[model samples]
Target: MDGVKKISLVIPCYNEEKNITRTLDGILEVFKSSSILAKYDFEVIAVDDGSKDATWAQIVEYAKKDNHIHGVRLMGNFGQSCGYQAGFDASTGEYVITVSADLEIPLENLAKVVELLEQGYDFVNTNRKNRWGGEKKAKSGMANKIISRVSGVCMQDRGSGMKGFSRVLVDNLKFYGDMHRFIPDYLTVYRAKMTEFDVEFKDRDFGVSAYKGSQVFWFYRSSYYRLWFLGNCVSYCAKTVGVQYWG
Candidate 1:
């Protein structure tokens, strides 16, 4: 498998000891069943975001057993964005996929993202139609809709943990303060060919959701920052044109 094109799977874990193993097994099963393992080399990178439980220990055990499995233990709980950034920096794969440790997003759907990548998409995001076995839709549907409307970017689900990116897209990311939620928008701005596909969503059976009410407030604030950044880009372009004409 030396010098072969590989896919790096990054799972960000934070006190998800009970769910981590299941998630890993699910992913491995999907890779085995889809025959993706035989076609290309792959690595599973688990980033433990200062887990206070057995998450780090489990990751270590897996990494020791399988050379393809790797683990990164952070010094402190640095949130999901940092965990993802750490994983991305550690990955050496030509293609990368970032998934949740809770198994809310099934690994079986990864094949869809990989298929789209094969068709020339630089980034592919999962759109979960039903969550927790209910057709109630995603809880963030309204907020995401507002974000898409304000940003002029349409995506069925924003902040969906199931996302795949080419090495080009991964290498260009700069994570800061919930930037993960706006990854699709960031990729689009960078001229990366992007697409989204429907995927299954499972309810977390073991652990509680880490997203709280406070995080929801931060999400909207982060969206404002994103809009401001976009505005600044336009303003800078206008200023450049003005200077050129006046001078």
Candidate 2:
């Protein structure tokens, strides 16, 4: 491999047949124009989480044409965490990233993530640069702030979908239920090195968003304390139980 690192982007799709191919092309274009990211090879792992549409068929067609593309299909609707788990299980790269299949966040901002990883950060996250001035956006923003404060993982956007993780971090972490939404907070349990930045958000031109807006926060609100407690336990055990140290 000539010492070159590989980055795998994991995108979870739920009825995103219209957007999947375009999303992959956008990432490829961003990589080609990026001098910083050119040194590394990249692969895409697209998981079709029981889409009623032809999402899986689109993934299969693209994969046949591009060797870097890998597709996995679930027998039934299993939510985002499970979709991500499927992708993670199939990934074979030094760095793994989770991105929205609808391209809500610009793919070009990926250069920032690669730079941060190269500089020694084990995880990287990005928040939208501007607020869209809507009731739902305001509500989700407020809700995320509360969620982050309660978990002591306060970043600008804890629920941000696009994030990067080192292979080491990915190996040590697992997602269950809708816990993927709280990855940054949970990473604190493993004591992973992390960083965050702002990436411009774009209006979707394809079908409407798959997410349920601010209501999406409801999936993990009850689990916030559970995660907080788990993080504390890890820290406590590190001092007394001589537990495995992730840092």
Candidate 3:
């Protein structure tokens, strides 16, 4: 908070036409109203992961109006990891933040993540408060809980899409396949400082979820997701070892 710093928000979108406008509005409103804006300049980089709908159109239109709002359109649906990688590669901020495109996680919590980073935490993650709202939600939470317990990271919400980290942390990150799910654990492997804050979660009222069930479920459904489940397992095991050694 000494000098004016920049915060780059990387949002990955895939056919989120119904929610994209709200997502953009939410972030812009934060910058306009939050006290953080007094000390930090912010940019929202939305990556359109080959959205079949009008998601890209919205991004383009918004970007033209506000130079701080940027857009990255992938050649094809490269999954969230690739989308994030694209945004990260293009980001020019000292602190980088990533969130879901669904707008399920309120945009207001983003200011808290940046606040923690300012307090010297290298990585800040969030936990879903209303996690018991649905069976699928419960199952996903259970899966992530198992992963966190087995990996020994203990954040309990490794899969949370809302996260904040420094540029150094982002540079050290290696994203591939569906490895974004274990982001908190990956930061642990790199010996980065991490903390978590609680935030309310909501169900998507617009678009459908891309990953419905098991990892392998997508392989049979689309070629873009083939072997993603296997890749996820490999990344999980490899990063877990790294955590055990460094942590």
Candidate 4:
């Protein structure tokens, strides 16, 4: 806590030109107000996931003007999970926090996440009390329930855009498909200590959500795959136990 090195904040952008500056400003404001700017070094890594618009250009301009801002442009669209992975791979920090580019998740909650980690949580996730409104909220709540039941993890929000993990946890992660949504569950299975905290959520100020009805089918398919994986893991463990008992 006294001599903490730099903290890296990774923002994965896909057509977020309209909200990038506002999000960056909010993060900077949080740091300034918390006096984190004075005590610890921090930097922002914005990954432009092959956005077709001016998202990459804006990030490049900001990075050029500010030494603390770094931008990475992918060759093609690789979805949000891969974008975050790219940023994570590029980050060199004592701690890493992944945030949305829509500015929906407040940067202020990051302080609480850092506090939890410093207190010994290997991974931390955001639990949003309010996520958008109306139909969106209903859908999110239902999806979260399904994910929690299937994964056997008690998470209020599965796809929350604000999550933090220590350097060790991040370094140990292995992602495939839409596995980012199951990070907490995966970490728990691997014996990583984790915690969750309430985080402020705001409505998206720009750009429509990319998630579609078709994606829902893929999500369910992925869930089934996860079930198969879990079954195989359990079978293997059972066999190991049986072998030990017999031998």
Best TM-score among the predictions, by candidate number: 2
The digit string of per-residue lDDT tens for model 2 on 19-65 reads: 99899888878878989878889888998888899888888888888
Q: 2 or 3, which is superior by lDDT?
A: 2
Worst 10 residues of 2 by lDDT: 238-247
- Descending-TM-score candidate ranking: 2, 1, 4, 3
Backbone clashes in model 2: 0
**After superposition, candidate 3 runs with Cα above 4 Å error:** 1-3, 134-138, 212-247
lDDT of each: 0.74, 0.77, 0.74, 0.73
User: Which pairs of residues collide in model 4?
Assistant: none
RMSD of each: 9.2, 6.6, 7.9, 9.3
Model 2: residue 231 alpha-carbon error in angstroms: 4.8
Pairs in steric clash, model 1: none
Tens digit of per-residue lDDT, candidate 1, span 14-102: 99999888887787777778865557788899988888999988888877777778888777787777788888878889889998898
Top lDDT: which candidate number? 2
Candidate 2 has an lDDT of 0.77
TM-score of model 3 (CA atoms): 0.82
